[model samples]
Target chain A: MSDSTHPDGYVLQAYHDGELNDEATARIETHCRDCVRCRNELAELQRLDGLLADIDAPELPRPVWPALNGALRKQHEARLGPAFAFSAAAVCAAGITIGILLGPVGKSDQSSTNGTTWEGPSSMWSGGASASLLEIHLSDMD
Target chain B: MTGMTDDQLMIRGAAGDEAALRTLIERWEKPVFAFLVRMLGSPEEAEDLCQDTFMRLISSSGRYRPEGRFQSWLFRIAGNLARSRLRRRKILRWLPLTSGHHETPAPGLDPLNALAAGQEQERVRAAIRQLPDRQRQALILKRYNELSYQEIAEAMGISVGSVQMLLHRAMSALKRDLSRGRHES
Candidate 1:
């Protein structure tokens, strides 16, 4: 019998896996041919590999596609929901802001006597008045 | 569709092509399903996790950089899910309410067929299940998934040397377990 320490079983796995270089493989092969213990270890490793390969994979259930599609749909909707809501809210907000700035469009025009100059209750509804008010507010913060 | 590579299909999938996503599913669901079944020991959980994995792939498509092979990335996702599920199961097992819940035999696996596989295979499966996570993963990726050491390392997020050492240790442990099982029998 040969010494087990010389060609340890750890390297045998590497050899079996074809991970070793040709020179190393040749050395192990030659040693195994003469050594009963290393040969048995090699056989054990092969047996393990065989057993694992034999373990078949089970079939996936038929509903996987529908379930996956449902999940994907939910994901897509989840992703789009907030953006859509924000956009709709933003459009509404802008419309309201502009409506407040413009102040009922032609309603104020008919009330003005000369109609040459547009005026409203606060005077901020007029374009130049609104810009000036914005400037004042911004400058005040500065 | 059949001629397209996984990455190519992934690109289409990222672009929101439903057909491309469906094709990708057809290509991958089996291997991924099998891998999960062996890892989780419960086909039901495996099936759920497998779906989750693809769902994630689609959702994160924009972020999908081909850092390595797509298969490696896929396994990485599946492996992470399996680990998380296992951890949850472990914690849940201690709770009185969940004590009875256990992994069942995979669906479609005949009881007679399973028994016909004989005692040795059962011992091998038991020993495999007993291995530490990294060891078991490395062994499975290499042996069953047919991944090279480099690919295993990529999927496992470990060094190549680590993968090599892990497999060696895993095999050593399995050998010991089998020997012990033989003695006991």
Candidate 2:
């Protein structure tokens, strides 16, 4: 219906799609009952929808999940691999510096002064020797 | 994991839960693939783009907000990829070597359908293909994907009013094209 009182194509489409509010829908429903033009327009829209629906997408092979997973894993590694390596390297460098600072001279000095046995970095890390080494190192700095 | 919503799955996927990602892929791959095929008019390209879409989803999952429907966000990604591929195809078509290339229909049609029905279906598909990109997208999202007008708007990054206008123009064009095809045949 192209008349001033009849719903336009946009309104008809909206009404056909159920997008109109209840009051608007009711108005259109009542109008369509007396209006052949609006009825045909609505039918045409439905028919076009049906025609499009008749064509289904061809059944292709399912996506290869394993390949996708592998790709994702590689992407993840590429993003984080360098950072992880850098962190590991930093940790190793810190450990080596600590070891050099607590070398044989530092250990012997601590042993002579505190009568606490000098232990390697391994023992220091194991909590048995760390406190005495820290005290000796602090005293040596003083 | 299967029972979880797409938003929940995306949240888990963002957190590096591979199973959640897998579930999301399994659930969405078909529909996304179908949408791509309709958009790109080639199953092979659709397959490639569909994979790309999921890859993108996982890569960008951390930034995904659960503010809208996951399906809308997902289709938006797929739609963008399809549009890019189509744009590339247009540029490539101008090349001398690729000038003669034509888009082929997706294969595997049921042979049992009557010949006339098959022809009609082809005509509709061809008519759909002839639609402008935005109109075709809006129409397909509405007709085939069954997205609401608001969802189509979100997927297309347009207002709802624009979506309605696109659909109206699309339907009018299809009716014209299909009717013209009938007369010529």
Candidate 3:
């Protein structure tokens, strides 16, 4: 067989691997039978495969599940930890803001209904408190 | 659960089913570890990376589409991690004081070689270790893992033609390397 007619190395390797389709396999088989070069190439590829097959993977020292499970658990917790903390902080902040907004209105309503202005703190504090109460009252009225 | 396919198990695993995850670990751990051990040449590192691969599988399972190619996807994750680990090892090899500590012994030199059993096997392991990473990966995936060309292409994220070429080059190199080893000895 001429050099040009012989299968390429990849095609020969594919043939050795049994990866070629039936038609291609037949073509290669016919060509290799007549071509010493292709036959040598296939033999060399098979020898290489055998050499590679001789090396075995070492045994695992122990079952990986215990350590893997632990790592996964830690990872799962690590993922949820920050989100859980953020959610709790958000809830706390919302609760605090709601208390701040509603506290003065209830207090002012009590003070007004009691007929005595409770001078519990400086006007600076009362002023801010009253401003919040006004905003709530206005919003309610609207 | 054991009868369920990898995609089915992964779907359950994504939904936080511990049993499915366990089943997956049981089913895949050995083959993955073997692949890693060959790729990285260290059973210790392979074991660690195998766990990491499954961990990645679970974490990414939510996005997994069941295409009957779970093994390819699983190996892709493992292959990426192995490549990253190899890169890190290369980088560490350049550092001054720590270089000695991080030197990768040929698999033949590994204490675990006692299990691998022969000097011939050791030479083969060392030859495999010397191949360029992509060629080595393609060769191992095809030769040891018994992946079809399409499956190897999927696992390595290369085309089937690329896989064929890699395997061709890899086998040629191994033949040359082994012949040299034989001549030297």
Instruction: List the DockQ of the predictions in order.
Output: 0.19, 0.20, 0.25
Which residue runs does candidate 3 get wrong by more than 4 Å?
A: A1-3, A82-142, B91-117
TM-score of chain A of 1: 0.52
lDDT of 1 by residue, B79-113 (tens): 88988887878833221111112234446768776
Candidate 2 on B1-185: residue-level lDDT in tens? 89999999888888877778888989988888878887877777887888899888987999999875898999999999999988878833211111112223335645554566767777887788888888988988888788999999999899999998898899999989987988999
Residues B115-173 of candidate 3 have per-residue lDDT tens digits of 43466766786778788889989988888889999999999998999999999899889
Better of 1 and 2 by TM-score: 2
Docking class of 3: acceptable
> Per model, how many backbone clashes are there?
0, 0, 0
Estimate candidate 1's alpha-carbon lDDT, on a 0 to 1 scale.
0.72
For every candidate, the chain B TM-score is 0.84, 0.87, 0.84
Model 1 DockQ, alpha carbons vs. true complex: 0.19
- Candidate 1 at residue A35, lDDT? 78
- TM-scores of the models, in the given order? 0.71, 0.75, 0.74
Tell me the TM-score of model 1: 0.71
Q: Write the per-residue lDDT of candidate 3 for residues A29-129, one digit (tens) a residue.
A: 88877888788887788777877776555566777777877676556545555554555567669967876889976665555556433231222112133
Among these predictions, the greatest TM-score belongs to 2
